[model samples]
Target: MAREECKALLDALNKTTACYHHLVLTVGGSADTQDLREELQKTRQKARELAVATGARLTVALRDRGLATEERAEFERLWVAFSGCLDLLEADMQRSLTLGAAFPLHAPRRPLVRTGVAGGSSAVAARALSARSLRHEAEGDFDVADLPELEREVLQVGKMIDDMEMKVNVPRWTVQARQAAGAELLLSGASAGASSVGGISVQERAGPCDPSKALAATVFSAVLLVAVALALCVAKLS
Candidate 1:
């Protein structure tokens, strides 16, 4: 039963590593996030379940009396690998969501409004319109639709990481080193052999902010100013 649990744990860790790699590749591309998001959810669920099944038994599994020295070492190695893969995956996914949230909720492609002014008036109006659009674009009008889901995902991943850390007193190695050793083991298809585990410092998650009322007021003022300027220009031309 212990051996079966070990194998299943190792397999789950491998799955996590694959998911992390896929996440890195997907995020670096222009592909839609729907698939990536689903995969993340599934992988996280598997990881949480694995932790529940194995965390309570880790102490016995790692004890000198439980298994041979070699077996205990191997178990530690897999734990290290699992920790590193999960750390990298969760950190990267959080970053992607944070950056994604900075984008405008709905960007409508709008052409500049044309006005019949044969003089410097047309130039002035165009400049005003461009400036207004640029300002709003910089304000970062985010979509709250995905914000709640992202926050929930982040919280779940964090809890999973924290739970494991509390359960296992692994070495405080760097994430890069753990990942490197894990990668080497995965590539060589050899027995796991490593001593490493590290936690990343997660940033405080920000809730969604609504700037619609302020944005609407800004837009209204800009439009009114443009209309007034255009009317003045037309009056002067006449």
Candidate 2:
């Protein structure tokens, strides 16, 4: 039973690590030029799925006493790996947004002005101004109008990325805490088991003689024996 539980824990931890690696790769691939928007969406989806799977596996491992110390350490390591992957994802999103915002779209036309005649200069200036105004109006109505909406969408996505990052890290931290608790429980169980084994050895060495003295020794030894057995049982189960 203990061996089986240890195997399950190791398997779960392996899966968690693989999922975290996949997340890191996905986030890193976000920079690929082809179908960037789609890639980003896919990366986010994969990260979310991995985070959920890791949390579920950790919960299952926590419920079993047969989990091994090495398995617990692996689980903690996977949590750290997942947390690091989430940080990379967040950073990647921020970098992509910053790069996208750095380059503004160029204006459709260069500014133009005409001057030659004293009165004609004014007329040409007026005509030039009118042309500029017309160009601005057309571009303004067609393209510039969407800039604010585009910026807002990007900001919204950034916020979502940040929120998801936090969600992923929170579960990893929880798993780490559970791993620590499991370690403590295993150590305490081992200590109790050793103490019980010691008492049993002493009792066996001192052969029965007086009724009252033997009864007291037997009772004391029995308690220690139980403690040792319980500890061994826990260790085996874990």
Candidate 3:
């Protein structure tokens, strides 16, 4: 039972790691590099937390078990592998941050023009060209025109963040499996050495059934029936 529980826990841990990895990969492929980097950093942080939690659970399980030295060593080796993955994730985040920060900000162009006095025909042509240039500059300066694209990108990033957060908070079935396994392990341990386990008394294990309470409940039910019968008899008599 203990082995089964351990296997369940390990399976859950693996599933969680896989889910997190998928999120990381999806974030990596995002077109919006800035948002992607931020989301990747968040994913890495979440992965680190998961690694720590899994490590703690594994340590607890190992300590409670009567495993051979070889088994213990193998568990430690697995932990090391998990830790290495976290380290790699952290390093990747650092590299991404650096690369993102190095992206140069380009300044928006300021429209410029110079026109000297010339012949009437030339001046008229130059004025017409100037008018067209001014119209183009006005169009370019309309920041509101870009708002829909910016809004769309923002919504996309927000959806990604929301999806990732939901995945983190939702309880995985592996967790449920691990819990069931752990409960079975504890119950089996209790059954093996019932007398030696001193914390919970046997009576407590028997739960809350009481014969006196059962008798009282039975008596009350009988009395209620008799009373209803008497009332019906009185109604018939009347």
Q: Which candidate should be chosen as best, given lDDT against the real structure?
A: 1
In model 1, which range of ten residues has the least summed lDDT? 195-204
Q: Residues 137-230, candidate 3, lDDT per residue (tens digit)?
A: 5555332233343344334434543443343332222222214557878888888777666535766787988899999999999999999999
Q: Candidate 1 vs candidate 2: which has greater TM-score?
A: 1
lDDT of 1 at 10: 62
lDDT of 2 at 131: 61
The regions of model 2 sitting more than 4 angstroms off are: 1-34, 59-66, 104-238
- Report every candidate's CA lDDT: 0.59, 0.52, 0.50
Q: 150-221, model 1: which lDDT tens digit per residue?
A: 678778767877877776666745222325556865865543222111111122234355599779999999
Ranking by lDDT: 1, 2, 3
In model 2, residue pairs whose N, Cα or C atoms come closer than 3 Å (at least 3 residues apart or on different chains), thus clashing, are 65-237, 65-238, 66-237, 66-238, 67-238
Question: Residue-wise lDDT of candidate 2 within 90-127, one digit each (tens)?
Answer: 55445544443332233346312122223556776676
- Candidate 2 Cα deviation (angstroms), residue 74: 1.8
Model 1 alpha-carbon drift over 4 Å, by segment:
33-40, 43-60, 63-68, 103-144, 172-238
- Worst lDDT 10-window in candidate 2: 110-119
Model 2, clash count?
5
Q: Model 1 compared with the native: what TM-score?
A: 0.45
